[model samples]
Target: MNQVEHVANLARLQLSREELERLSTQLSRILAYMEELNAVDTAGIPGTTSVVAGDANVLREDEVQPSLSQDQALRNAPDAVDGLFQVPQIISDR
Candidate 1:
């Protein structure tokens, strides 16, 4: 009956002696805010890319567009013949 009531009775949870005294003061203030984020310093930082690092290799211009004309691409076939497109009998002419 101690360590947060032995972790609220191995988590079958039924807290309320004021929610185990307010969850042990909110788990010691979330472990003192994770020990103040384990003290940061990030030295010699060179891990950056594109905070507007645009225009380093943008080249586009090989143009050749005009497609679709074989009778307006077989004019939406429901089963075309001489201009092709009639599929339905999937496998087994064995």
Candidate 2:
């Protein structure tokens, strides 16, 4: 099997022969580009974390706010018991 077929199997994907061939060529080109990037020299350059210029915090302050009561919150629930929303059991005891 080719590299694309192996990768598809690992990802649990069922690709056709044509798709495998196409992906193989695309993956080869991507890897070749990565190799070319790896060959660049950056001895005196500083590493960059963000491409944006500003380092300011852009978030609002966290403050206490009034929220809905139990009845108001559970008013739109399809299933509610006591004061909480109830969901169907997903796990078995077995």
Candidate 3:
């Protein structure tokens, strides 16, 4: 408990004596549980990325379709110019 409080003081945490005592017991249990996990033998298991079986692809079909006109494309712009959508000016031409 005293060691936990001292370390907490060095870490700039304001921990009371009772809080430090409770946290010290809990931290010891946590470290013991982690040590138990370290004793497992995972020898010949295949390494996997995702827990779920996934089979996704991104190979799109090579096909072209008719597109909208220039007037239809610029219909949703806040501002536009001659047959083109226009964006705001970033910096002054100083």
Candidate 4:
């Protein structure tokens, strides 16, 4: 009836006794590491928004590319009309 068990129940998980014990130990170690990191002195350091802070737009130039024709695209359609896909209407005209 620990925090791990409670969380497992909430997530609809059915962990075995051994798995629960192992996870509890692992979670404890992870929490301890976080606590150790929290004790570090970070007074004069500015918070970094991104890892690549120097480059604002790190992307390639947008180029117009040739694509498949209408016939090629609609070739796999089960039902097509006027070069477009035809599907069953969900809403009725009231």
Model 3 worst lDDT run, 10 consecutive residues: 49-58
Any runs in candidate 1 off by more than 4 Å, and if so which?
1-10, 24-26, 40-94
Model 4 worst lDDT window (10 residues)? 52-61
| Candidate 3 whole-model C-alpha lDDT, 0 to 1 | 0.84
Segments in model 2 whose C-alpha atoms lie over 4 Å from true places: 1-17, 63-94
- Prediction-by-prediction clash tally: 0, 0, 0, 0
List model 4 lDDT by residue over 1-94, tens digit each.
Answer: 3999999999899999999999999988998888987788999999887888585976877887799999999999999999999999989999
Q: List the residue pairs that clash in candidate 2.
A: none
Question: Per TM-score, what order, best first?
Answer: 2, 4, 3, 1
Angstrom error at residue 6, model 3 = 3.0
lDDT of 1 by residue, 9-28 (tens): 89889888988998899998
What are the root-mean-square deviations of the candidates from the true structure over C-alphas?
19.6, 6.7, 13.0, 8.5
Q: What is the TM-score of each candidate against the true structure?
A: 0.21, 0.41, 0.36, 0.39
Tell me how far the alpha carbon of residue 55 in candidate 1 is from the true structure, in angstroms, after superposition: 47
Please name the candidate that would achieve the greatest lDDT relative to the true structure.
4
Tens-digit per-residue lDDT, 18-89, candidate 2: 898888888888988889867789889888877778856688779878999889999999999998889988
